[model samples]
Target: MNYFFSHFHVYRSSNMILLLFLLVLHQQHYFIKPIYAYSRVEDLAINCGTESNSIVLANKRIWIGDATNSKHFSVLESSPQKNQSSISVATPHRDDPYGTSRISHYEFTYSIHGVTPGHKFIKLHFNPASYPNFHPSKSVFSVKAGPYTLLRDFNASGAAQEHRDHHHHSDPNKILLIEYQHCIKVEPGQNLTLTFIPNTTHKDSYAFVNGIEVMSLFKYHDQCNKQKKSRFRFSEVVHHEESCMNCSPSAQPPPSQTKPASISGGVLYCVIAVSVFISMSSIFLLCIWVWRNSRMKHKAKMELIYEETTNSRKSSITLASGNSCRCFSIIEISAATINFDDIFVVGVGGFGKVYKGYIDDGTKPIAIKRFIPENGVQGVQEFKNEVEMLSQLSHPHLVPLIGYCNDEDDMIIVYDFMANGTLRDHLYGTCNTPLSWKQRLKICIGAGLGLEYLHSGAKFKIIHRDVKTSNILLDEEWVAKVSDFGLSKIGPNGESKFHVSTEVKGSLGYLDPEYSKTKRLTHKSDVYSFGVVLLEVLCGRAPLLRKVEGPKRCLVEWARSCQSEGPHAIDQMVDPFIRGKIVQECLSKFVEMALNCVVHEGNQRPSMGQVVEGLELALQLQLKSED
Candidate 1:
């Protein structure tokens, strides 16, 4: 029982010790304070005698010694207790005014392990070695004259290893001896302070701590962009302002010495130079492209306009048998209508509206019939045909043709204006002011003369293919003038009656039954259509009245029934307002002319010339009866 208790006690003690060691290590790792390391260089002072030797001594250089010199260097590491371990020192070299030697450099390291972190204090000492021929100087040598520091919270093993490498590599006679006695203790969250002295401009020699070669702070440029090439410069040292605690965050810290002092200025110069070159090149190419394009476009536009004007001028000539037509522009028509105001509106047609306008040089107003052609392909040909035929033909009762204008899209014909409007308007409109028998006879005679001219008087006997009350216009004195030559055709022969085979064309009510059947045209075709208009003038009703049903209500059928039913039916056939106002002999003669024109057989119908003669004699007889 005693042995078992002894072994148990030993085991418990061992475990407690292990536990205590682990706790100590844990506290050191988690709660130890930090210290920042730094290095610097300084100058030392020495004195000589009052003679010239004093000046020489004042100018004398001081340096770390070679291997043969008896100045040893070392570092000490320990806790707050009096225990210490020596670290090795490295060789140094004599300082020369013009030579930067490699041997004078040395480094020392020490770890502040197990030391409390606070404002730690350090002491450094130096022992000067005397030469056999030299005397002691008034000034004492100080190791603190060079860069020195005290550190806490560092790796003790690492510091010791670095010190060993530095000494082992150095020559034995060149080791400098150093003496120091100081202690520092720190706890957590404390900082270690280090102080250093530096050489001034007056010093002949300087000292520095051996450490890693750090890059110097780079100089910043402040020259304007334009002055970079000519105004930039560099100096040996650069100056900057540091904050009391830390470098100001807003301030731009100095750059490392990896780049040369002139690097920024050179980069800016190269960029500016390249940018100017590129800008000049781009401008030159752009100018050339624009110039070429402008020249080419100008040439093309001029060519197009020239071609259009040439084609228009060529089309102006009247052709006797070709389909080419000349057209006037909308601008010219706009000018003619004075911008299509209400005042210039003369009449309306099936396709488009008409307006009365005068040419630029003329005072007489001309009726301009404007229409979009149903068959656009044949529009220009039809326009030229009408202009050529109308300009060449002249007759007293025909609507006289004036000059025309040609522009790209619009085609217009100018004609002498009729002040009294169309016969359809007069016979059917509210202005039903009953025409005197004398005026009716005259209107019939004038209209018959216009048809006679179209049938025989023109250089080429033409066919007034479309003849209706609307196609006839009146002058201020009520002189009937044949108009609307859109469907009119010139005889194939110049002066003889020629039948030009064509498609069926004529107004519905006045269309010749024989022509609509056989599609053949002759002069008597005009006579059949005229017969319809004559009946409309005599009676105020249209030839085909929608009021009656079936095909027999036509004026010709009703007029034919008049003769069979006798003169009493004739009185009803005429307008009631103009009944009995017309003389019996004149009415009979006028009805005879109309009957002869509308004969079913084209060969049996009287010519327009013959109709004109009959209408004139009837007009004279009616005038006599009125007197």
Candidate 2:
């Protein structure tokens, strides 16, 4: 009886403790608060988080304001891994109304690449959250100079809200409002990308202007711009005519006006018929003359421009596929580069430099790569191998070869120009704008898909010997397109491995140590390079880090050490700016995939197909949680 009583008491006590904890948790969660502003509509004040409160500048910090008290306001831009210091603005007076507060006029500085002079002012009045009657017929922001001038604001508040919260349509705090304006340029083709968070508002808010959305192709005809302008002019004429009619005196038939009405109508009809005939005839004649002149002039001008462009663009290739491949005349290549001006140079590599050039009457822009030629048949073998292999493969991720131009003086391979540049530039600051988290995730997935396609989807086995961030080019949508096939290897039919005992060639930090020593290249070698790139994505560190102790500091070595050290070890390895956002499961799987790719033995490493699968899984997991 004593033992039974003791056991029953203990069980009852545990149940009571759990019940008490549950009640406390329920109460705390149920009473959770939301932001509220009780001030009159006219009393509210709003401001942008920019230096000098000017919306014309690049760096906009953070948007923050208070409804009631004149408290110190703060905004912070911190490293991803560490807590950021607050940038506070002290209130001059404590007891001031919302609109009358000194917070109405403010200035601050935020640094991206450097400290740029800019401003953040309250350009508009009203908040989307509190002010239910907020509506603006028109809003405009002016630029200092250049082709971009004034931008007309458009409605972007709806899509902004819908997309931000996984289409749940329940997020009250999400700001769906987007202000927009038109972009102007002098190029033949107009390239525009409008990117905004889904769910909020505004259809006119473009993604490209904010540097958040990028894309690849803009295939507009040269005459399209002129045609569009003409259409706009025609529409303006019609609108003006309608507006004028409304303002004009009414033309009513009076009691004595019958005699003149028939004569006036007849005159007007005759005049309209004559004007139409003359206008049509003149337009036809002008079109014919312009076409003839442009065609004749274009042929001669194009040849001359091609000659000058190709000379400067085509750098000398040391290794030639002489006799084994077709070679063009030096004059032909010279016509492609327009005398190799500095503006044509796109990138430079150890073997040679790449240039942007237009060929075939300036209708196409091709990537002209000049490489060092080799002395023997191996050079010919490599060139033939790359071309033959590439011809057989077709995928959206891989760069397609239009053709190759090889002269005795220079060699050039043509590929479609990737407008958004490289993955390296996007992540680590290229041209100016830094990539957002959303862009980075999209880039990773695209790159993985490309690798997956090459490893398994391709007709024959093709290995991307140089798989680094630099090799990954981004399209307009920030989609990753892998390039650089100079060092690629093709496998024999039905045979996965074609044992090629050749000298190892690849980027320094990305080279597989085992392959380097053994001189046996395989698909696993490409896998190893991919692992280094994965590390870069996770840690935001360069493939090669300086070793304080010796010259042996590789990213893989450091990652291996971190794994055994502790969970925080990987934390230390992560890029400081983005540490908080790194999902643990995703990080773990990424690390695991990378390590599998970097195994001591080639056979042990996971294939590129598997690596891509793991990365996709990791990406899906991250997206689901963030949603």
Candidate 3:
């Protein structure tokens, strides 16, 4: 009896260990449950433009036709009298549910009802090819699911071409199919509505879709919540002439009926009770373990990052006002930006979007730059550099750094807002009022002063690696402030070291030819970029015009050629808005200074101080001319 009991104890211990091991593996996603294992509360697949009762695809999904729609959905058209039509494709790709598509010249909507509320995967299928009367190029549209804008001014042909180019396909005429997938949460009892609107800005534009699928996934709640915390909120609904049609009770499909299991009441009750208790106990223990492990890992990671940042040299630098830069929490940043709503977006750049936000109880206006790590390490390094450099340096002509947020995986920087926007906005783009010749001169002088300070006034010689009109911001008082220091670099510290040997990184067309060839960075490289900006301000044209051909494509080369031709040619190249406003002497001096800064050799370029003096002289000459 003792031997038998000892054997039983060993057996039970081994089984319990195995069970714990399996549970840990499941928590780590080592064991992926099959699709059929999920309790799918809702599944919808529509074969658009088809009249068939049912079609089974290769993926084992059953799709019903939307043409003879039952109570599940109702389609509303912008023009009920004209009515949108359906067309069949000549060649359909393999595994395609149906070759037909519903095409619309105007806006349309689909209201789907009776969907069990949760996070759903929304899929939209598109075939970029010519139809009977519709062409792929003209198929430009926007798609919206409730308040979320899935696609804005989307062009299927361009997307398909990009897909082909990405795969290195030489054949440009290949028919390509594309699918866009998005995940959205639907509150309980709320219906799902999808709107398709043609790009009204483009004439003769249309919208088309081949299929639509909406299915519930079991593990979407955590993912959706995380996404919401990281990204901006959904945009408002798109305004259109047609209104969305609501589904009535009679239009909804009949409730699904499930058969009851036949078993002895007493035995079934006991079995269910035991199963529920065991399952709940196991799940509760697993949750605790997972939570504790994740919490410990996250805490350690954050502490390491904080230690590194605090130990950095730049972090010790304090402002002249006796105030150091504050480290903001994610909650504070989110509150200031209103959870990064779309309406607060002021501008978009290579790194990410900039939001106009108010902080300190709406008293302090700030500009928040959210760094999105799209390029992985490069983006992260840039974010760190921006924080380090800006915190160490301060000047009246430089945009002030308010604070930063490096919580979790997010990287954000806050700055003093520039109410007047960028210099490029007034020079060529959309600003209705054009700056006078004198105003332009003053702005250039201010910007040059800022660069001079960075190059000489700072503790170490700093190079504004990227300098252009867009980076030159204007304030309410028209003071030109240099912004965007993500690419800025500290130049050689001692007199013996003339340049920093580093990889070339700057905007194209503004990049110095000598630096590009030698991989040597110096203040002269910034002078070269600033020279390009000088010409940009004078001609009111971009640094490089991709659409233009020959020397004219590059503003620097074209300006050089025009200067060689004489003052007459230079006058012709001037921006028409300020063509005759510039004095002859001022224009000649300005052109000479710009050309000297952009010479082929870095050593031949003017120093930042010299550039500042030249700009100041030009400004004085402009004032004399105005008098």
Candidate 4:
């Protein structure tokens, strides 16, 4: 069966004739083929040193080996190394796919453009022999083509079957040429990107590609798409009459004699056509009515989202993924927030001011962070990202997004109010509570769990690029829940790259130095920032203090220096408020773990899973000291 996808708009010239042609075509199952023309096939070759319009390396590409002479798929730069793989492939030219080898530590992307939108095929060529030290399992990687994930934690070596065990067909001389195919739909004005990212779940992970090729698929499918079919269906009746000449007179059709196309029968044909049009119109309206009724039933109201009464806080409501979130009107949010009163204001940050609002006689209070008008479109996008991430990710350690409001100048997100507020407050902000050793341990552990879950527990790994003490909140029961996913990005194995390699954006002193220098983001970047937060918890100094002089102003640097001086010197780095409360054994390990995280290199830092384990041990030691 041939499918003809037509443009929704039809021709206005010869309107009646065009309608008649379409009617006949629809009845006869005919197709109107589009004129086919396509650009020549283009090949992208990467040498890893130079920037060709077509090649993608980690950060830069090599110029000497580029052979394709076509636009190169661009990617971030990696350290250039000589070819030393065990298997060798024949190279015909400088722009050939097998030219030079470039490697990436985490993830990178290649942008392909300069062509029309439609189905385009990409062939990714890989040379796994470049990684001799790591086993096949450690070589898992992924590739994303637009919204489609072409590969996921794919094992190139095993899938290639070059290391076959004692097989007759297996020849040692045969080189394993691993290539992947993907057909992507690139829309108008949108450049297609093929991202290569290492799998984070595996150990000794890295991504590498020797070559890539991009080609237009237009001409390949043109033969079938350009086939034209005849539109006339009027001849079968005329042929039937001749064949029926030998039959009896009683079987002679009187309607055929009258002929429906005759002028006398025009009124009857008009009535039949009008009746068919009315029937179609009625069916269309019925479908619309049913769709509207379904939406009305699925959507919930703001009050119904989570019920609150004068007696007690309402039961926490969990929404099914399909549930339509409550869309609050401006009047309702204003009433709940007391007309955006300053008295209700709880916190203020880069995005906007957050106000604590209550419903049903203050029984259930919620935190409302409204966008500042100055933020413009960026504020709206952040609000959208937060709502999207928070709704998809639901954990006890994560602050739940209760609802949101978008009306007039407002773009606000309502979260489950953390009565105790930010962890940064207890350590350094206005609250300044002298939190006991156990309480501090609990808060840090909770935050670590949140980060750990984000890295591996949720449906997708999330890189909370802005992981700082201020983003960690304490609920009424003092359970720490990580809040604010505005800067969070889906991590490795996503349709995008494994790690989001973008501009180095995060709070000062909390930003990862490696990420800042290379602009390559990973889950470890969050670990580096969390290490700074850990230092804040231990020493109670801000990440960057303007008053302090020299390196002492940076808390992590100061703590690292004290930590190198051994146990006696670490005592001085402990927060004076909780100095005597910390156990000697606990302090040593805690400081060591935090220092381990702050190390200049990202790979050296432990994952949040390991961080949680270390913090738990420290907490246990602190309890023993109390005993």
- Listed in order, each prediction's TM-score against the native is 0.47, 0.48, 0.53, 0.49
Evaluate residue 146 in candidate 1 and report its C-alpha lDDT on the 0 to 100 scale. 19
How much is 139 displaced in model 2, in angstroms? 30
Q: C-alpha displacement of 525 in model 2, angstroms?
A: 1.2
Task: Give the per-residue lDDT digits (tens) of candidate 3, residues 1-627.
Answer: 564446456555656876997899888785664332445566778777777755564457777777775688877777555634434343344244436677878788878878776777687877766777777789999999877787888887676664443233444434556666666878777889889899988888999887788877443231232122111111112222334576566777678795665578767997687667556555666776798799999888767665554444233333345557878888777766656755457679989999876666655667899987443456667777887788878788998888888776678989888877789877764413668888888899889989999999997789989999989988878899999999999898756898999988898989999999999998999999999999999998788877667988899999999999999999999999999988998999999999999999889999889998998888888788668
Span of ten consecutive residues with least summed lDDT in model 2: 229-238
Candidate 1 lowest-lDDT run of ten: 215-224
Q: What local lDDT does model 3 show for residue 262?
A: 57
After superposition on all CA atoms, what RMSD does each candidate show versus the true structure?
52.1, 31.8, 15.0, 25.3
Name the TM-score of candidate 3: 0.53
Winning model by TM-score? 3
How close to the true structure is residue 512 of candidate 1, measured as C-alpha lDDT?
90
Query: Against the unseen true structure, what C-alpha lDDT does each candidate score?
Result: 0.55, 0.52, 0.76, 0.67
What lDDT score is found at residue 71 in candidate 2? 32
TM-score-wise, the better of 2 and 3 is: 3
Q: Summing lDDT over every window of 10 consecutive residues in candidate 4, give the lowest-scoring window.
A: 230-239
lDDT of 4 by residue, 1-627 (tens): 011112111222234555786799897654553223234354444443233334336534433233234344445332344332212233222333444344555566666657567656566666444344545557678878778777777665654552232122244444445555445666778777777778878776766666665656433322111111101000001111113454776875566544347665787888677567555555655665687787776553323322222111222234447745666777767766657755356788999899866654444567899987556445555677787788888788999878887665567888887877788777753313457778988999999999999999988889999998889999867899999998888877745664677877889999999999998899999999999989988887678866557867778878877767777778887888888778788987898899889999998999999999999999999888767
